[model samples]
Target: MIMMTVLCIILGYLLGSIPFALVIGKLFYKTDIRQYGSGNLGGTNAGRVLGKKAGISVIVLDVLKVVLAAGLASLVSEPAAIWTSLACCIGHCYPIFAHFKGGKAVTTMFGFLISTSIFIFQEFSYFLVPLFMFLIILYLFKYVSLGSICASVCSSLYITAQLLSLDVNNLFIILASWLMTLLVIYRHNANIKRIQEGTENKVSWL
Candidate 1:
């Protein structure tokens, strides 16, 4: 069991460390995404550095990182699968291949949460509700971080509610949800401070 868990995590991390944004930037534009706007190898910065198309493509690829990880883990153990997925998210945030520098965890986190919520719980509402809320928040406020934070909180609340209603002691998932929430918020700390100072970058894609 322990060996499987460790292998799953390693596999997830390797998959997560692909650095698609960086690759895209270098291969097509002859630029380093990390040296561009926001200096982040993330979807938002990919848009800012390359274009909306690049950003969208990068997000799609980034999401696949977690999806692949989860799929691999699901073949081994159900519980290990979630942890492996999260490990992938973390890998995207701090990739070993990239000298531990990577994108914020939001995109990867959403990928895992959405995929798992739908497949495991047989409920698209759990993922869609928060996603709709995220879009609304982003459109109204123009702050991606703000929208992400709010949506993450809502997702956690909804998951907790679902577990409670089903009378399933899914403590691992409950804890995982909250932990992911906090991790995302923490990662957006700079954005939060900028928002407080009225200097946060308003996303232009919306």
Candidate 2:
């Protein structure tokens, strides 16, 4: 078990650190995505600096990293798997290769939630209702930071409610989820301030 857990952590971290946004940006645009637009190697920055296509590609790749890490970890042990998923999310948020700076891990968390098998469709539906709603709101308001924060909070709430009602055995998952949510929120502190001052960046279409 110990060996499996260690292996999962290492594998997940390495996988999560691929830095797809940087890669795609450099490959197609001949520039480092981190050099522009909020200076974040994330989908939002990718979209702003690169293009919508590059942004979507970055989002898919980031989410896939979480899914791959979590799924591989599950093969070891349930607890290890959950921890591995969280580790991957951490890696995405603060990639060591990128001077410990990275994206907010919003899409990565969504991937983890969707990949977990413990919850059935009903539970997932309850979770997704708020998630999708917030996404819509974000799109309408052009406040990606607010949307990401609200979605993370809603996900944590949904999981906590599931723990209370369904008696699911994995408190680690809930705890990890909350921790990641907090981390994401912390990374967005600047955005929060901009939002309060009504100086936050909005979508170009808006």
Candidate 3:
């Protein structure tokens, strides 16, 4: 079991560290995405430097990586699947293949959450709740960082409900959610500082 868990984590990390945003930017635009807007190696920055199409594409690709990892780890067990999801997020945050420089873990985190919810609840409503919270917050505040933080916090309420019910099956889910929250906040520390000084960037998406 332990060996299988370790293998799942390694495989997830390897797949997650592919740096899709960088590849897309370099291959098509002949530029380094990380050297551009916000200097982030994720979809938002990719969008800023590469345009809406490339940004959306990167977001989809990043989400797929997490979903793929969850699918593979499901063969092991629920806990192992959660571990794989966690590993993928970590890889996205600090990709080994990218000199340990990566994005702020927003898209990747959402991908993992949506994928896990699919497998755990197998219900569309399970994905809708937090997604609605995220979109609403983003739409209202025009700050992607705020939306992400709020969405994760809202999702934690649902996961915490699962935990409080004494559902052993959800133990790993709760653990993974909290870890994602901490990692996301840590990654967004700079954004948090900017927001505090009312200097955070706000993109109007209408």
Candidate 4:
């Protein structure tokens, strides 16, 4: 059991560290995406540096990696699934394949939320609510960073509310959700500072 859990963790990290933006950029665009825009190996930076198609492609790939990680871990144990998802998020933020420089963990965190909603809670609302919140905020603010941060906040709070309403205590799920929320916020510290300074980059199109 322990060995399986450890293997799941390693697998989750490796999967999360795939660095799709780097792959797409270097393969087709003949550029290193990390060298442009915010230097973030994320979909937003990929879109800004490459194109909308590339950005959407990177996000879809990144999200699938997390889903795959969690799904594989579920074969071992449910707790392993949750922990592996967390490891995936950590790997996304500081991917070894990307020289320890990586994305802000927004999309990876959403992937985590989606997996947990499917496997653990079986509650789609937990995933859908925050996704809608993210899109709405992005539409209003035109800042991906702002939308991501706010969506993380929304996810944590909504998860907490759901936890409080449930008779069964899901301590691990609650803790994991909050941890990912904090990670998303921490990863966006620079963007938060920029937003405060009124210099944060905003998406050019709605």
Candidate 5:
């Protein structure tokens, strides 16, 4: 079981480290996304540096990676699935294949929320609620960073509440959610500072 869990984690990290944003930017535009915009290897940066189509494609690919990782881990056990999801998020943030420099992992975190909600927790609301929250926040403010931060916080709070109400003894899900939330916040520290100074970039297309 332990060996299987380790293997699942390795698989998750490798999958998450695929760096779809970088790949799409380099392949289609002949530009490296890391050298442009916010220098983030995330979907939002992809949209800014590349185009809407490239950004959307990168986001879809990022989400799919987490879904695939969690699905494969679920074959082993729920704990493994949760761990794999966290591993994927970490890899997205600090990808080994990307010179250890990666995005903020906002999309990757939501990907985990979607995958774990379906494969491990069997609770769709965990994914849907945060997604709705993100969309509403994004539509209103046009700040992807703000929306992502809010969504990450909402996911953690919702998961914690659900675990409390349901009396679920397994703390792995809650741990993973909190970890991802912190990671999102940590990765967005620069953005947060910019927002305070009223210089944060807002999505012009929105």
Candidate 6:
């Protein structure tokens, strides 16, 4: 079991480290995406640097990597699988290939949520109430950082609620989710400061 768990984590991390944004940017536009925009290899930065279509593609690819990692992990036993998923999330946030600097793992978390089957489409209305409310607050105020922060907080809350309500036996899931939330918040520290100073970047869509 221990060996299997370690193997799963290594596999997930390798999968998560495939910088899709960087690859897509170079392939489509012959540019290093990290050189432009926020100097981060993430979908939002990709969008800001390479227009909407390329940005959306990068987002989808990143999300797909998360899904692949989590889904493969799910094929294993309970706690081990959860640990593997968490490892994947950590890899996205701090990829070894990128010198321990990576994206914020927002879309990766989205994929994790979707792959876990926590809230199906039928229950999405209930799940989305808080999500939409957060979006509104972020959109109206024109603070993308605030919106993302709120969203991550709400995601942790939702995950905790689900774990409790479902009586999940896997403690790793709870631990991993909490850890991932904290990591997301930590990654956004600069954004948090920008928000406090009233200088955070707003969504262009807003």
Instruction: Pick the TM-score winner.
Output: 5
Candidate 6 has its poorest 10 consecutive residues by lDDT at: 118-127
Candidate 2 achieves a global lDDT of: 0.78
Where is the poorest 10-residue window by lDDT in model 3? Answer: 118-127
lDDT tens digits by residue: candidate 4, 82-145: 8899899899999999898999997898899889888778889999989999999999888899
lDDT of each: 0.82, 0.78, 0.84, 0.89, 0.89, 0.70
User: Worst 10-residue stretch by lDDT in candidate 1?
Assistant: 164-173
- Please provide, for model 3 over 106-179, each residue's C-alpha lDDT reduced to its tens digit, 9 standing for 90 to 100: 88888878777776656655567778998998888788888888877777787787566566767667878888
lDDT of 5 at 169: 35
The RMSD (Cα, Å) of candidate 2 is: 2.4
User: Runs in model 5 with CA error above 4 Å?
Assistant: 165-169
How many clashing pairs does model 1 include?
0
Q: What are the RMSD figures for all models against the true structure? A: 1.8, 2.4, 1.4, 1.7, 1.5, 2.9
Better of 5 and 6 by TM-score: 5
Backbone clash tally (model 3): 0
Residue 178: error of model 6 in Å?
A: 1.0
Clashing pairs in 5: none
Write down the TM-score of every candidate: 0.94, 0.90, 0.95, 0.95, 0.95, 0.86
lDDT string for model 1 (1-206, tens) is 88998999899888888888999999988999898788877888898889998899899999987888888787777666777877888788888888888888778878878667744566788789789888999989998889989988998898888775543336677776787788789889999999999999888863
Tell me the deviation in Å of residue 63 in model 3.
Answer: 0.3
Superposition error at 191 for model 6 (Å): 0.5
RMSD of 4: 1.7
Candidate 6, residue 71: how far the Cα is off, in Å:
1.0
lDDT for model 6, please. Answer: 0.70
lDDT tens readout by residue for model 2, 103-145: 8776777766665534223256645755796678687788988
Off by over 4 Å in 2: 117-123, 165-168
Error of 6 at 114 (Å): 1.3
